[model samples]
Target: MGRIIAIANQKGGVGKTTTAVNLSAALAARGKKTLLVDMDPQGNTTSGLGLEKNELDKTTYEVITGEEKIQNCIVKDLFDNLSLLPANRNLAGAEIELMTVDKMQFIMKHNLEKVKKQYDFIIIDCPPALGMLTVNAMTAANTVIVPIQCEFYALDGLTQLIYTIELIQKSLNPDLTIEGVVFTMYDARTNLSLQVVENVKSYLNQNIYKTIIPRNVRLAEAPSHGLPINLYDPRSSGAESYDLLAEEVIENGGEN
Candidate 1:
């Protein structure tokens, strides 16, 4: 069976989608057959990986809504080992509609059940809110990775996210666990960055990753070209950081 990891955070602009796209790409680069599931209605992950959202006939929304099978929905990307279950604006209405449905939280989990064993890893890019969609993702995942920007009020959201994790663990998936945190858009020279890192590490204890993603223009620009940083500029710092982060994930998974 594959290890399913959800890249999730309730806060936006924290590099959640960026981590999902790059991590899936990097893991696929390591020869793992990976699936990148774009659960966010924004479809940023879909477009960020060079996908044209209009060309997709089926999406993750279709799968979650029982309109299509995951196998039929997965579209290949530039990475040979990576496949994507794209999402678009159609997903924006799912939360409200799903709330009225029976077994609401199981929709996404059930959609992925058939295909979960097909990949070495499944990465879910969750919407930036602690809503029904994120609940479903948490229920489906074995682990959850949070990408936090080293900015003002980073720790403010941390408390709420951790509390949500606790609730999910108690009520939904008992096997679910915190997969550590990665600091994004970090400026190494800033005392503020160091202070934020210290605060997060102190709070989370060992549930924080050593890899810190620096603010790189290439990372910010890659999405515009619909490319992962690794594909856009493999020699860049952003690409190297994600590559090393993937390596650390693999090592932590004890496969290295």
Candidate 2:
């Protein structure tokens, strides 16, 4: 079975979607059969991977809502070993619709079950909120990777996120575990960035990846160009950091 991992952070601008797009690309480049699921209604992950969100008729919205099968929604061979379940603004209303459905949190989990064994890793890009969509992602995922931006108030909202995870573990999925925390947007020239990293290391009781994603212009620009950093500018520091992070994820037994 694939190791379904949700790239999530309730706090916006924390590199959650960036990590989701690049990490999935890096894993695919390493020869892992990967599925990138865009659970966020913003569809940034879909576009970041070079797919036209609006043009797609079938998407994660339809899959989760039972309007389409997961297999039909999957866009295969977008990159070597990479597949995508695209999403768009149409998914924005799913939260309200799901609230009226029975076992709403388990809808995504059930849908993904039909195709989990086809890939080695399933990376879900969750929205930047603690809403029903995020709940569904958590219930579907076996693990979570949180990206924390290195800046002031870096730890803000972390406590609430942890609490939500605990709640999910207790009531929804007992197998869900935090894969690790990654630091993003690090600037070596700033004492503040270093201090934030150190503070988080000391205060947060979680596994922190050694590879810190620096604030790279290429990383920020890749999404607009509809390419991952590795495909857009492979030699850039941003690409290098994500590749290292992928190695760390595999070394940590990603297959499990």
Candidate 3:
């Protein structure tokens, strides 16, 4: 079976989607059969992978709402080993539509289960909120990778996110656990960044990946150009950092 990992952070502007896009692309470049699932209604992940969100007839919205099947919503062979289940603005209404449905939290889990064994890793890009969509992603995932921006408020709301994870583990998916935390937007020139990293290392009782994603212009530009950092500029520091993160993730294997 594939390792279902959700790239999630309730806090926005923390490189959650950036990590989702690049890490999935990196894994695919490493010859791993990877599936990138865009659960966020914003659909940045869909566009980041070069898919036109509005042009697609069916998406994660339809899949989750039972208007379509998961298999049919998947866009295969976007890259050599990468596939995508695109999302769009329509997904924003899924919570309200599923409110009356029994066991709605398990809907994503059940849908993903049907295609779990077909890939090596299934990476989900969750929205930057603790809403029903994020809850569904967590309930369906074996683990979560949180992207924390290195700044003064890096730790803010982190406790709440951890508490939510604990709640999910206890009430929803007992197998759910935190895979690790990744530090992003690091500026080596600033002591504040170093301080924040040290603080998180000392206080947060979770595995922290060694790869620190720098605030690279190329990283920021790639999304607008509809390509991953590796494909856009393989020589850039952002690409190097994400490739290292992918290696660490692969090294961790099925441990989490």
Candidate 4:
């Protein structure tokens, strides 16, 4: 069985999609058969991987709605050893559609079952909300990787997220666990960033990752070019950070 890890955070602009894209690429670069699932309606992960979101005919919406099979919806060769289940604005209606369906939270998990054995890791890029879509992702995942922006408001809403996770653990996925919390957009020069890191480490302790992702122009530019940091600028600090983060993820045994 492959590890299904949801890269999730309820807040936007926390490097969630960036982590999903780059981390998947890094894992594939290491020869792992990785699948990147764009669970977000915005389709950033799809577009970030050089796919034209608007040009896609089949996407995650169809898979979640049972209109298409998981294998038929997959876009392969986006990167070597990487496959993508793309998404687009069409997914915006899925939330409403799923509300009327039975066993709604289990839809994603059930769909993933058909293709779970083909990959070493399935990295799901969840939407920035604690809604049904995120719940489905959580219900499907073995664990979750939370990316927190290094700022004063960094810890806000985390308690609620954790509470929701516990609820899901009890009711949805009994084996669910938190992979780790990674600090993103870190700036060494800013005392506030350092303070935030110390604060999170003090509070979460072992739940936080030692690798901190620095804010870099290269990282921000990669998505525009439809590339991960490693492919965009392998020598950059942004690429280096994600590479180190990937090593930590692998060392921790990938959601085990």
Best by TM-score: 2
Per-residue lDDT of candidate 2, residues 26-71 (tens digit):
9999999999999999999999888889999999989978898899
Q: What is the TM-score of candidate 2?
A: 0.99
RMSD of each predicted structure = 1.5, 0.7, 1.1, 1.1
| Cα lDDT of model 4 by residue, 183-254, tens digit | 999999999999999888887744788889999999999999999989999999999988888889988878
Best by lDDT: 2
What is the TM-score of each predicted model, taking all chains together?
0.96, 0.99, 0.98, 0.98
Off by over 4 Å in 4: none
Error of 4 at 233 (Å): 0.6
**Candidate 1 segments whose C-alpha is farther than 4 A from its true place:** 254-256
lDDT of 3 by residue, 117-192 (tens): 9999999999999989999999999999999999999999999999999999999999998999999999999999
Residue 95 lDDT in model 2? 94
lDDT of 3 at 204: 94
Better of 1 and 2 by lDDT: 2
Query: Model 1: per-residue lDDT, tens digit, 82-162?
Result: 999999988888888897899898787887888877888899999999999899999998889999999878987778888
**Higher-ranked by lDDT: 1 or 3:** 3
Q: Is candidate 2 or candidate 4 better by lDDT?
A: 2
